[model samples]
Target: MVAVIKSSASIKNVLQYNENKLKQNVAQLIHSGNYGKDTEQLGFTDKIRTLEKLISLNERTKLNAVHISLNFDPSEKLDKETLQKIADTYMRSIGFGNQPYLVYQHHDAGHPHLHVVTTNIQRDGKRIKMQNIGRNQSEKARKEIEKEFKLVQAEAHHLKQAYEIKPVNIQKVQYGKSDTRRAITNVLDVILPTYKYASLPELNAVLKQYNIVADRGKEGSQLYNSKGLMYRILNDKGEKIGIPIKASQIYNKPTLKFLQQKFLQNQTEKQRHKLRIKNAIDFSFVKRPEQSLQELINALQKERIQLVLRQNDKGIIYGLTYIDHQTKCVFNGSDLGKPYSANQIQERCNQQMQRHEQKLTQRPAFKHANEQKQSALTTAEENGITFKIPGVKEVFKELIQTEQEGSLAAELRNDELRRKRRKKLHH
Candidate 1:
């Protein structure tokens, strides 16, 4: 199964663009929370549109929107089109079309999945209740979809059981392996219902609170109480779900602390990477080669691109152009600070333009434009507009004369009617 979540606030715009077909196939209202009577009475279209609008609003206010869609795997006999039809029918069963919602099948990404777009708002213009409603509804919907599709309940068996493993140490213990395992086991069984510990330390704390001691082996003066040892935690089904392992195994094998530190470090690296991307677009101090703002905008527009300006800590403006969805190239905006020499500015502009043109050539649009031009020429000839051939000239001339006569006749009738009106008034 695959899942997708999206939230949007542009219900009207999205529906109107698609001709409102989304609101027509809704089967039923599964659940509505917090909006009271107004939401309860909303039809499928209104409900969907309202929710979509709310999602958009939520994105604007919270800088995030959440949507989730899931589908079952198809059997061997079913092809892609069959799988999509099944997904669509399942969506309809869940009231997808009756409300203002969008459901899309994405088969490009390995597995077949559905993309559901919904609003976070109700008919009364209030935000959906956030009391874990999303999680709860998703779980409920998943089960129903699975049941409706008659999908096999894929097994949750653990491959770790195939190996005979021994506990390293009971003392110098972090959380007792057995109890930590049981706690995790219970969590997986859905007994706890809230398992938010994404890190080893947090998991360690939970195990400790449950009176579970976690211990690791020691070597010389070094205690092997690293984060790698925290992998013993199991859910009620005895599945190794919330386990953390270290990258290094033989040489200086990972401990629980090392694993935790690595996870945190990796998270920090990811954050830094995202920040760098954002800064490239918004930082002011990043120097652009030396083009004026107008010149930069013109260059980007010529290349079918958009420029994003960012202010840096030094109060300098930096301009970065988004070349595509996944790539951005930076330019120097320092010319905004002081008057630049004509030679320096001209050289910078030329360099920037060269880079931008080179980037554009690498884009899909370059090839797509060529194909489109070729197709347009073919179409023109098929319609007799490309009549450079000797034999087709007579046919083209006759067609043009017919068109001109039709136009002249329409004009003459208008003029004669106007003259008749003028003479009637005089009489």
Candidate 2:
């Protein structure tokens, strides 16, 4: 089994995410730890009030909410009772057994998994220290639980792959075939906390890649003036389809105002990856000095860096965002440096394009000029006259269309073709 823990400032947001899953019928309340009522008996308000009461006890404890996912091998078909037992034991081992928490069996993946939502605040109003809890307590608990239950070990599991936190498989998300709002919400659940994008467009830059987008509508429109944001899914053609889900309706209420706060915070948090992105772009150019813009984009992609070039309807690029999948960071090109700005990168691409076009246009003309000269020399040679010009004669000597050279060339060509055919056959 594999375990992952995430801390959030709002238990409400954490609870809402899971409950929303339950409402969609894709998740279930398997076990409610330390709650007065059973998993099926407890209501949403009851669950929220019970956890928030302790959190309210400590005013300074902002990050009290904990979201933990326990993943099992896809081949392990554990029943509800077994899953409950394992979850309870894992919680007790990790010191969260006594806390008011909810365990949900999520059926959104290829494997069996449980999402536990709880608060770290103790009943006595003291906040439980969560720093390194995942690396320390959770790690210890996971290994023991695996051994105690005789389950498949994550390191040496039969599947040869460990289940971890992964973004939704966008390719499988078809509109009407799957739950639309739930799919979009699941995307937010992963992306909002994972990627550091400061603004709406920056956030959309990451979201759109997953076939989701956050829109504030046109300027001065009702939704825009009200500072409202809606997340909509895009089709294969990148057109918005189906109904749009309001940002307020999603987990954590990722409203325009909420994003403004993230913008300030991410502006600083995303700085640590600047040098990494710059080095990637610099190395791409150094690898091949004469590569075109598309080639440059492809090279960066090989390094897990995505260069997003945004253009207007007129086909003029207006913005650039570099998404580094390796670091899980996104940055507007202007934020990196002037050299990486849209205008400057466009300038570079334009120069490379011009050079490429020059090569294409000039090559055939040069070849044709040589062919004309060669033809004139061949005609003179066939008339029984020596074709000679001062410096030009020596330059054209090897290229002369002589009978002997033609037979020798044919033999060499036949030899090359034979070698190619033999190589193909051998392969």
The TM-score leader among the candidates is 2
**What does candidate 1's lDDT look like per residue over 296-366, in tens digits?**
55554444444444345784544332321122222122322222223343455677668776875555545
Question: Could you give the C-alpha RMSD of every candidate to the true structure, in order shown?
Answer: 30.1, 7.4
Q: Candidate 1, 220: how far from true, in Å?
A: 41
Residue ranges of candidate 1 with Cα displaced over 4 Å: 2-64, 74-98, 130-135, 154-427
| Residue 373 CA displacement from its true place in model 2, Å | 6.2
Estimate every model's Cα lDDT from 0 to 1: 0.41, 0.81
Local accuracy of candidate 2 as per-residue lDDT tens digits, 9-101: 778888988887889899999888888887788998899999989999998775678898898988788999999999999889888888988
lDDT of 2: 0.81
Give the clashing residue pairs of candidate 2, or none: none
User: Considering summed lDDT, which 10 consecutive residues are worst modelled in model 1?
Assistant: 323-332
TM-score of each: 0.26, 0.72
